[model samples]
Target: MRFRMALYPLLGDLKTICLTLAYLYGLTVYDASYLALGKLLSGDVYTADGKSSKRRRGAK
Candidate 1:
């Protein structure tokens, strides 16, 4: 079996975007970080938290 890992630095722009997402979505910075990263990578974000998932779906 093989696995791959990629490291991404959380720089100023990403940090600022996370902070903005946190404020706009009423989410903690921690949660917003996931969203920010997903947006940056043009990928989807999946969460175990049902409430958060619901909120995200509703936002779309």
Candidate 2:
């Protein structure tokens, strides 16, 4: 009975850790995707449809 009682809290903690890890993994994946999209659609690289005419380094 005592062991079972102790196991309950341990199981709860394990579940919390698993959920936290899943959340962090999701956040990491989302961050990577956001950066990839930002790079892909960034300034005059793929199109001239940008909203600004700002100059970049080493540009004429």
Candidate 3:
């Protein structure tokens, strides 16, 4: 399987985003931003094991 930079169009500035997400989540910025952007655009993300998303009780 391959992953594309699909979040770029949705979120313009990636370099800054990487740093921001990394700092917030204590993850490698690029990797954290990639996953963050995916979740923002798609509402969920798929990993090797399964899928995950922000669990909001009243949002959905």
Candidate 4:
């Protein structure tokens, strides 16, 4: 019977993988502005929920 004890190593690897994913996501969002072509092609670039671009005064 072989009882596995690779928990620590597995956890460390998982942590590294998660960090890398987060890093990539952050980079993508950070460079989103530079990739405006794609967004424009997809459609509207402004507005948070695709509602309206007009900002009402004193509604901040």
Candidate 5:
């Protein structure tokens, strides 16, 4: 009976750790995906139409 009491708390702690790990993993994946999407959205691309007027670093 005494051992069972000790085991209960250990099991609860293990469960909590597992849950926290999963949440952090999900958060990291979301952060990575967000960065990828931002990069894709903010990239400079020229279209077939004559609408791009990009400027260089050193030019009049």
Candidate 6:
């Protein structure tokens, strides 16, 4: 199967969400942004950073 990727511009609301996630999760804004986008699209988030992944899972 082929997966297509699209670019999304982060607007004000997304930036705010990312900031909040970063604060709540103790993740960098960059990592939180990925989480925010996953929440927005109702999609799963995959990461190579085990520590961050553990933190995300623990929050749930």
| Tens digit of per-residue lDDT, candidate 4, span 1-60 | 989643222234444443443354443322333223323335443435322223211112
lDDT comparing candidate 1 with the true structure = 0.77
TM-score of each model, paired residue for residue: 0.74, 0.25, 0.41, 0.26, 0.25, 0.78
lDDT of 2 by residue, 25-58 (tens): 4433323333234334462333242332132111
Q: What's the count of clashing pairs in each model shown?
A: 0, 0, 0, 0, 0, 0
Determine which window of 10 residues in candidate 6 has minimal summed lDDT: 51-60
Q: Write the per-residue lDDT of candidate 1 for residues 1-60, one digit (tens) a residue.
A: 999978766788778878888888788788788888888878888889987776556322
As a whole number from 0 to 100, the lDDT of residue 13 in candidate 4 is: 42
Best-fitting candidate, scored by lDDT: 6
- What does the lDDT read for residue 56 in candidate 4? 16
Clashing pairs in 2: none
**Best model number under TM-score:** 6
Better of 3 and 5 by TM-score: 3
Candidate 4: segments with Cα more than 4 A from true spot: 1-10, 27-60
Worst 10 residues of 3 by lDDT: 50-59
Could you tell me the TM-score of candidate 2?
0.25
Tens digit per residue, CA lDDT, model 6, 1-60: 999998877888778878888898898888888888888778888888988897777433
30: Cα error in model 6, Å? 0.7
Q: What is the C-alpha lDDT of each candidate?
A: 0.77, 0.33, 0.49, 0.34, 0.33, 0.81
Error of 6 at 55 (Å): 1.7
Candidate 1 collision pairs: none
Who is ahead in TM-score, 2 or 6? 6
